[model samples]
Target: MQTLVQTFMERRGDLLTALWQHLGISMASLVIAMMLAIPLAIWAARRPKWAEGLLQLTSVLQTIPSLALLGLLIPLVGIGTVPAVIALVIYALLPIFQNTYLGISEIDASIEEAADAFGMSRMRKLFKVELPIAMPQIISGIRTALVLIIGTATLAALIGAGGLGTFIMLGIDRNNTPLLLIGAISSALLAILLSALVRWFQTAKPKRALTVFGVILVLLAGGGAYSAYANRVETVTIAGKLGSEPEILINMYKDLIEANDSHVKVTLKPNFGKTTFLFSALQHDQIDIYPEFTGSVLETLVKGTNPKGMTAKQTYALAKQRLAKQEQMTLLKPMKYNNTYALAVTKQFKQQHHLKTIGDLTRIEGVLKPGMTLEFIDRNDGMKGLKKAYHLNTTAKSMEPALRYQAINDGRVNLVDAYSTDSELRQYNLALLTDNQHFFPTYQGAPLMKADFAKRHPQIVRALNRLAGQISETDMQEMNYDVNVKKQSAATVAHRYLVQHGLLKGAK
Candidate 1:
C-alpha cells in the first residue's frame, strides 16, 4: 500500500495529466451522447412507434465489445482521442437514451393534460413540468453513462489516447505492481467521483444543478482548447511499439531532440500498437519518427528477400535503400544492439541436448517443442523460414511473449523464439542458440522517419544520430531489467541512460 502511494505521488504530474485527458474524453463523449440521445429519446417519447426501433439500434451498438468498437472506429477516424471518444459515445447511448425515454414517458399524463387545459404550449409544459418531473430519472441515466464512460476510457491508452490507462498498460508490460495499482485505483476513484457528482446534480436544487453543469461544461471546453493548443505547438510526434525497450528509445529520442533544439517541441506517443501500426502511422503522417528494426522492415514491411549470409551492415544498408525507394521513409544510423529474434532454451535443456546452435536443433528434430509468439509463428521470416533453412521439422506452438520464458523454464516447452534483448535470458538463465544458418535477418535498432520530416529537421536527425553505436546489447538488457525486474519506470531508466552517456544534461 505504501509503495503504491509513493508511486502515485511520484507520478502525480503524469497522473494528473492523464486524469485531465480521461475527464476530457469522457465528458466530451457524454455531452455528444446526450445531445443526440436526448433528442432521439424525446422524439421517441412523443411517438411511441419509433421508440422500439431506436432502442434496438442503440442496444446493438451497446452490445459491441468496447475493444472491437474502438478497432472499428480506427480506420474511419484514425487512432487517438477521436476514435476513443467516438467509441465511448456509442457505448454511452443506450443507457441515457433508454432512461430519458422512460423518464419522460412515465410522467403522469393527467398533469400534462392539466397543463394543456391551462393553455400551456407543448414546449412550455415540457420545460415547466415534464422535464423537471423526469429530471431525477434523467440524472440517474446520466450517472450510469458517466460511470461507464469513465471506466471504458481506460482503454483509450491502447489507441494512443492519453489517460490513466497509460500507467496501467505500462505497468502490465513492465510487471510493475505499484504502477498498475495506482492506475486502477485512480480510475476507480474517478468513476466514484463522477457518480457522486451526478447524484448530487440529481438531488440538488435547480439553480445549483444548472451551475454545476455549467461548470463542468466550462472545464471540458477549457481542457479541449488546451489540448488543441498543445498539439499545435508540438513540432515532432514520436511513436513507439508497446514494450520497455521501445518506450526507452522513444523517450531518448524525445529528450535528445528537445535538448538539441529548444524550439522543437517533441510529443512522445509511446505504445502506439504494433510495428505495422507504427509503419502505417509514419506513412500516413500521424507520427514523425519511431524506432524500428532493420530486419522487421526488410522482411515484413518492404517484403524484401534477405540476402543470404549478408552482414549486419549490409542488411541495414538494404533496408535503408528499400525504405527510401519504396515507402519514402528514411532509416537513421542504427544503434549497436540487435534485437532480432533468436531461438532460446533453458540452460538445463541446452546442456542436456548439447545444443549450441540452430544447426543442433535439426539433430533433436521432433524432440524439441518450440514456443514462439503468434507473429513469429505466422511470420515468413520466423519459424516457417527457420524450418526451411535449417531443415528442422519441429512444430512450434504460438505463445504469448510474456509467458514463453516461463514455459521454457517450467519445461512445458523446450525451446522458444526470444528477442536478443529480453531480460529473461539473464533472469531465467536461458541460452540463445547460434543462428549458424542465419535464417533471421539482422535487426539493428534505428530511427525510421518520414523522409520529409527528416529533411525538414536536420538538427533532430543529427541529435538522434549521435546515439548510434552508443547503446549496446548489454546496455539495453540492463535497462529492460531495470524496468521489468527492478520495477523502475521507463522514463527513469531512459533518463539515467542519457545522463550516463552524456547525451542529456541537467535533471529532467
Candidate 2:
C-alpha cells in the first residue's frame, strides 16, 4: 500500500501529461470529424447515389488494421503525434459521418416543409429546424467517437506519441502491476468523464452551455499553446542495447537525470541483437550509451571477433582504451555480476543422471531437450554456437520466455538458457552446468557512455560508476526475487537496494 502511494506520487507528472495529451488528441479528432462529417452528411443526403459509395469508403478506412495503417503512415508522416492523430481521425470518421447522415435524413419532411412555408432560407432551416432536432443523435455519435478514440489512442505509445499508454507499456515491460492498474483506471475515468460531458451537452441549453464550453475550450487552447512553447525541450536521444542488465543501468542514469534536471531527456533506443549490433548503434549515434560486456567488446569490436585469451579485467581495460581512443566512448567501472549465459538442467534430470557439469551431459546430449528463445537459435553465440564450441549437440527446441519457463518447470525440457543471475533458477532447483571449455563470453555489466556526454554529466557518470563492482550474482538474484517473485515494484526494489548499499542516502 505504501509502495502504491509512492509510485502514484512519483508518476503524478506523467499521469497529468498523459491525460492532457489524450484529451487534446481526442477533442481535436472529434472537432475536425464534426466539421467534415456534418457537411459530407448533408451532401450525401442530398445526393442518394453517392451515399452508398461514400459510406462504403468510410467503412473500408475503418477496416484497415490500426497498426498497419500506422505503419503505412510512418514513411510519409514519421513517428509521433501527427501520424497518431491521422489514424484516430480516420477511425473517428465512420461513426460520426454515419450518425450525422442518419440524424439529418431521419428528420420529418413535414418539419422541413413547415420551415420553408414559414419563409425560412435553407441555411436558416438547417440551423433552426434540422440541426436542433438532430442535436441529440449528433452528440451521441460524438460521445461514441470520443470513447473509441480514447481507447485506440493507447496504441499511439508504440510510435512515440506520448499518452497514458506509455505507462502501460512500461508497466508490462518491468512487470509493474501498480503502474498498469493506474494507467488503465485513469484512462477509464477520462473516457467516462468525457462521455458524461457529451451527454450533458446533448440535454442542456446549447446557447448558454455551449457558449461557456467554447470559452473554456478557447482558454485551454491558449494554455496548451503556451505550455507547448514553454516546455520545448531540446531532445538528446540516448539509445542503447536491449539486454536486461543494460536496460537496468541506463534506467538508473535516466532516473537520476530526470529527477535532478528535467530539461535534458534521455531516451533509450534498444538493439535486439548482440554486442556487435549495440556497438554499431553507438557508431551511428542511434544509441548514446548501453551497458556492455567489456570482454565481448575487446574480443568482438577491437580485435575483430577473434580475441583468443585474456582475463576478464585485462579484456575490460583493453576495451576501455580502445573505445576511448578509437570510438570516442567511455567505459565506466564494471559491475560485480556477470550475467554470462549458463546451461541448466532441472533438479530431477540432474539427480537421475548425477549431472553437475557439461561433461556429465555428454552421455545424454542426444536425448536432452534444450530450450532456447527464437533469437538464441539464430544468434552466433547462442545455442548452435554453444553446441559447436562445447560439443553438446542437444536437441534444440525454440520457445518463448513464458513457455520456456513452463517447459523447464514441468520437466518437459531438461536444459535451458539460464542467465547466471536469474532468480528463478534457484527457485526451481536447477543445476547450472559449468562451462569447463569456457565457450561463453565474459558478460560483466559496464555502462558505456559517449565521451562528450560524460563530460557534460559527470555527476551521473559518478553515481552509476559507484554501482560498479557492487552487484554480485547473489545480489542480482535477490533483487530479482524481490521484484518478480515477491511482486515488488522495480523502482522500489532499486531504491531499497541503493539505500541498503549506501549508494543513495535516504533513497528508500
- Colliding residue pairs in candidate 2: 239-287, 239-288
List model 1 lDDT by residue over 143-199, tens digit each: 889989998999998887889888888776665788788889989999999899888
The alpha-carbon deviation from the true structure for residue 201 of candidate 2, after best TM-score superposition, in angstroms, is 1.3
Compared with the true structure, the alpha-carbon lDDT of candidate 1 equals: 0.86
lDDT of 2 by residue, 1-508 (tens): 7877777898898789888877787777778877887789888877767877889888999999988897787656665677789999999888888888888889999998999999999889888999889878888888888898999888776665667876676665445677777788888999999899888777788697779679758976986889768648654454334333444455555665555555666665432234554565466554556777765566456644545555678767778899888888899989887777778888777888888777677788667888877656765556767777767766678875445666888878878887787767766777788877777777787888789978987766766677778888888888766665676655566666776877665554
Q: Which runs of model 1 end up more than 4 angstroms from their true locations?
A: 47-49, 106-120, 227-234, 303-310, 349-378, 383-416, 434-437, 489-492, 495-508
User: Candidate 2 overall Cα lDDT vs. reference?
Assistant: 0.73
* Each prediction's TM-score versus the true structure: 0.87, 0.64
Q: Whole-model Cα lDDT per candidate?
A: 0.86, 0.73
- Deviating ranges (above 4 Å) for candidate 2: 1-18, 35-38, 47-50, 69-80, 106-122, 160-162, 174-178, 215-247, 255-478, 485-508
